[model samples]
Target: MGSINKTDLCWGDNYNLTEWYCNASNSIASKTYNCPYGCPYFAYACKKQNDVCVDSDGGKNWNVKGSITFANSTRTDHCSEISTGPVLVEYYCDDYGRIMEAYNTNCACNEGKCTDYFPICVDSDGGIDYFTGGQVTTSTSTIKDFCGNQLYNYTYESYCDDFGNANYKTYSCPNGPCSLVNGSGQCPSTTSTTGNVIYDLFKKVKIAGKVIQGIIS
Candidate 1:
C-alpha cells in the first residue's frame, strides 16, 4: 500500500476553509481580507477599511483646530486657507504644513509711494520764499509808519526747507534802496538827492489826497 502524506488534510477537517485557504494562498491576505493574485476570492470584501476610517474622522485631517473668520467668509478645520484684514496678514505654511501668522504693517498707505519733506523760507513780513543757491531775497513795500507818506522797502534773505517752511534774515541797504543782484545786496554807486526830493514830494501829495478823501467820507 502507498504511504499517506502527513500534511494532507481530509475534506471533513474542522478548520474554516475560507480563512485558511485565503491566508495560505497569498502574503497579502494576512494584512487585508482581500486576497492577492491566484486566489479564488481576490478582491473579495476588499472595500478598503482604512478609507472608511479616514472618511469618518475627516475633520481630524485639518491641522488648525479653530474656526477661522476670513475677511469675507468663515471656514472650519481647513488647511492652507487664507484670510485678510484691514491690515495685511502674511501667512505661510511651515515645513510641517502648519499655518503660521505674521503682520505686515508695511502696507501701501500712499499707494506704495514715498516722498521727501522740503524746507521753505518765510520772511518776518509774512512773505514766503524758497532757497535755491547764492543769496535768495524777498522784498515787500510798505508805508513808513502808518502815515502813508513815504514808502519803505523791506528786504529779507529767503531760506526754505523741503517742507515749505520759510525762514528769512533781514537785509539792510547801506547806501540806497535794497536790491538783490546775483543773489547779493547791491548798493547804488551814487545817491541822487534830486531823486529823493522828487519821491518825497510825490509821497506827500498822495498822503494829502488820501487824508482829504477820508475827511470827506
Candidate 2:
C-alpha cells in the first residue's frame, strides 16, 4: 500500500467548521429556555447553576416566572419575570441600538404602573413644557382660596404634531363656562379683547410649532 499523507490535514476542531457549528446548534436546540420579556427575537444563553436557571446573554438575570420551553414542541412556556426594582432595570432601545431611555421600577409611585407615569418632555411657545396624564379632578372644597374663598377651574384638550408641542393656551376659571369669552382673530374684523385673545393664542401656537422644528433638527 502507498504511504498515506497526514501532513496537510488539520488535527483539531478547525478541520471542519461546519461540523462544529452543527453540533453547537444542536446542543443549544436540545436545552430548555426561559426567555426575556420582549420576545423570542432576543437570543438567550442559558445554563443551570445551583439548580436554578441563569442567562449568559447581556439581558440581566431574572427569575423564571412560569415554566420552560423546548425547541421542537409546538407549545412554549418562555415567559420570565424580571424584578426591575432590585434585581434588574428595564430600558428602551431604539432600532439603531441607541439607548433612548433608562428607568428603574424602584422610582414608581404605585409599584405596578411605573411606565404609565414616566414624565414626558414637551415643547411650547411659552417655554419648555412638561406634564403628566389625566386631569386632576378637584372638588368645590379643594378649589378654595387661602382666605376660605372659592376658585376657578376649566378643562379642555389640544393636539400637536409628532414633536411634543402645545396647540392652545390652557384655560381655567373660578366658576364655569360663564367665565369664558370666546372669539377668533381673523383680520379685517375690529380688534377686541376676544380678538386679542385668539390672535395671541394663534401666535403662541405658531411659535410652539417652530420650537418643535428646532428640537427635531
Candidate 3:
C-alpha cells in the first residue's frame, strides 16, 4: 500500500490538479493534469460601470457619440459630435487633435463685416473721374460757338451717386460776340473791303508764288 497526495489549482474560471505518491525512503513522484480549458493565471481585471469599460492595456475609458458602442480597444477610436448654429466664426478640433479656426461667410455680411464702398465714374466722353459728396470739375476744353465769335473755354464737372452712376454738367462758351484772331494775334476785318484786308490778301498771294518757285527749282 502507498500514500497518495493530490492538489488542485484554480485560476480565472479554470482548474488544474496534481497527484503525487511517496516511495519507501519518503521520496515522492508527482504528475500534473490540466483541465479541458487552460487556466490563465494573469487575466486582467476590468471594472465595468455605466455600460463602459476601461482598456486593460491602455487604462483609458472608451466613449462613443450618441448610442453607438465601441468594440475595439484601439487608440485611434474617436467620437464626433456636430452642433449647428448661426456662427460668424467657429473653432474646433480635427481628427488629429489639432485646433483649427474657421469663418462662416454666410453670416459675415449679416454681422456687418464689410468694406467701405469707393465710388468711381467713367465719363461718356472717354474720361475717368472719382467723386465724393459734392460735384468736382474734372476737365476743361476750348470751343467756338455760333457767329464765329464765341471763343471760350468750358469746364466739366461730375455728379455721382452712391451707386457709382455719374452725370456730367454741360458748359458752353461764356464769351460771345468776339472777333477771330489771325496768326499774328491781330483781329482780321469782317468787312469785305478794307486796306488791311487787301494788303493781307496780296501778301498771301506773294507767299504762294514763292513756294511754287521753290518747288519748281
TM-score of 1: 0.18
Please give the RMSD to the true structure for each candidate, in Å.
29.7, 17.7, 32.3
Those runs of model 1 whose alpha carbons end farther than 4 Å from true positions after fitting are 1-111, 115-154, 161-163, 179-217
In lDDT terms, which candidate is top?
A: 3
- TM-score of candidate 3 relative to the true fold: 0.16
| lDDT by residue (tens digit), candidate 1, 170-212 | 3223344645445443333344312221122112323434432
lDDT-superior candidate, 1 or 3? 3
Q: Residue 23's C-alpha lDDT in candidate 3?
A: 63
> What are the TM-scores, per candidate, against the unseen true structure?
0.18, 0.19, 0.16
Per-residue lDDT of model 2, residues 67-132, tens digit only: 222222111122223654332233223332212223343323232123233333232212311121
Best by TM-score: 2
Error of 2 at 78 (Å): 14
User: Tens digits of per-residue lDDT for model 3 on 11-125?
Assistant: 3333343445576788876655554433222111121222232232232212211111222222222222236433333333333222223443322122212122222443332
